[model samples]
Target: MFRNIVVGLSGGVDSAVAALLLKRKGFNVTAVFLRNWDTADETGKCLADEDYKDAEYISKKINIPLVEVNFVKEYWHEVFTYLLESYEGGYTPNPDIMCNKNIKFKKFYNFARENLKADAIATGHYARSSFGPYLEDYKPGAKVKLLHAVNQKKDQTFFLSQVSQESLQRCMFPLGEMMKTDVKKLAVEAGLGVIAQKPESMGICFIGTRTFQNFIPQYLENKPGNFINYETGEVVGQHQGIHCWTLGQGCRIAGSSEKLFVLRKDIKTNDIFVVPGTDHPALFSRILITSKPHWICEEPESLIDSWTVLNCEYRFQRNEKLCPCRVYKSSNNKLIIVSEKEKRAISPGQFVVLYLNDECLGSAPITHAGPSLHSLGEGEITSDVDDNDGLLRASTV
Candidate 1:
């Protein structure tokens, strides 16, 4: 068993409980509070100061030493730069995913193992793995697969889809099988009721309380664009930037008998195509082409053979229901996914996380959504092909 364990306390009930559990399990626990953001609130006060104080309270009461580390430079290089590029490229990217991939799992993992000289690390994330929680059943140098938490309501595997294999093997999730209600109950029982009652934090970590539409303009110039109706190609209104809009959401434009929703965004033309209603046929996508996938483990054996079509489940949004899909090779050998049912608002730059029952297989960003149900006849629309290289018209889907 690992003697020295480092637990990341986020100043929430979740991480507090995680560290408490590790201490109770007879491990030497050290609490580390990471300061990843250097931003200030509207009042010009450091946004993370409160979180740090709460973390200190939890560590003090739990009788564990607390340490603070700043990763502002590492965070900017790994996560922030990617966010800027993805937004400038006209794709809405999720920074939280990048944070897990680069910060929590990679940077933080290395810090704990080398700097802290710890045998293992733990977090409050509601995720499990093929390697048991706390790694009681893991063998050295063996493979590990991230799995869905028993608490489906709080399952965070989608955010962890991009984590590396090494990180998965050494991390522990004490809350994997515990319910939120039970976790809070335990926190209260442990005399940490003040920590247990804190409201869950939300939004981009650095953005803090500011709306996305507002916070982004501070970093990137607001390039002007036009909202063109998909059916008529008539300019409805002007938008500050394509970065401000997302597919399948209400378009806040002026003077229309009906409200508009985004259908497609053309980065080169600086134009956004819109539909009349939220349920517009153009809003639904049945297929999407993706970049090469980043599998948490090795590529599934089912896909080891070239040109093999694999049946799997996928979710674009973290909380989205797992929808049935088929992943196969395209005529250009691109990774293509066709859904059993048309999905609404499938956007470019968003990742499609693949799954097999409970285990997270991997994820790939949607490079080109095949074509909305109602095609605009523009952009990189795709059609699937047979193994023999003949084009199979996926448009009829």
Candidate 2:
């Protein structure tokens, strides 16, 4: 029932379904396909050419105009460079987060509104938006509140947290209310062609099934380094380079009987350390130093430094345990997490997201990690406890 809208048609079922939903609701809709990467060459051999074709077909079937915007140069200048820098700095940065905040929503939104004259832009992301009776009712100056999808398992609010408040107001997520199964079923019911049964892309958002290392040689000058075990302080193996691996990665530790996961990487020593086992509870950490916290609400008028209870998820584990945490600042102006529980594997460069109950509060980029403790909350502690803690055990040095 709204006016003009633009849906980011990615040639995926979710996007196709989203566009269909808008049309069914009787809203004026157009499909905008962003050409982020070039796949016509050998470099794009692994790319999904079929998906693009399907997207074009779906737009035709829906009777909506489709627009193609080439963002390959932008992707290289903005996203690819950022990704390389994060990795070179020995951090596991989430490219999807930056991609959404910088390109898809920021640049794309501007083009769609200023050039296309669209009232709003939409995507098939698995996150929800709550629009009030009127725009002013949502927030005083803000337009929308992005929330986790009803399907918690598929919720992508984590990737969307970096988006600005203004961008969120003008955004729509049509498939946010629908479950994944329902989304696919709708695609089938709509008579979408070969794409209806296409297997979902599971690798990196942009480069599917391609070894990132293969692409890294283009940007990073990899230098092979010594791999060691922290406990023994002995050279266990040699790595292709510290730049080639990330924190908590367990594969390819030299000369180890126990399966080792990467605990830390030392830039000065050019060394990488590994710990045994993937389920080592020590790999998880309750306390982590976070930086660059962004609030979706209005910027706080004054500097209010206080501790508040917030929901936290380190990764996409289904049963993400809750830990009480207090957020404070360090002498050098970084957010430090002092926790009530001994969590594990706090990785530098990974996103430490905060939540208020089910709603997203904001997030911070983890810059540093603190030492692991033996005891937490009045329990008989042992070295095994440390092993189970997952923080020190999985901590990448």
Instruction: Score every model by TM-score.
Output: 0.94, 0.85
Off by over 4 Å in 1: 329-333, 376-397
CA RMSD per model (angstroms)? 3.1, 4.9
The top-ranked prediction according to lDDT is: 1
Q: How many residue pairs clash in each candidate?
A: 0, 27
Identify the leading candidate in terms of TM-score. 1
User: Candidate 2's residue-wise lDDT over 84-188, tens digit each?
Assistant: 888887887777777888889988898889989888888988887766211223444544666778888788888887888887887888766778889888888
lDDT of 1 by residue, 1-397 (tens): 6889999888999999999999999999999898888889766878679899999999999999998989889999888989988888888798899999999888888899999998989999999978887889789888998999999879999999999998888899999999999999989999999998888878776777778888889888999989999889899999988888888879768888899998888889889999898888778767777777889988887676655788989999987788998787644545678788878888878999999989999898877675565663332234433222422444222
Residue 343 of model 2, lDDT score: 57
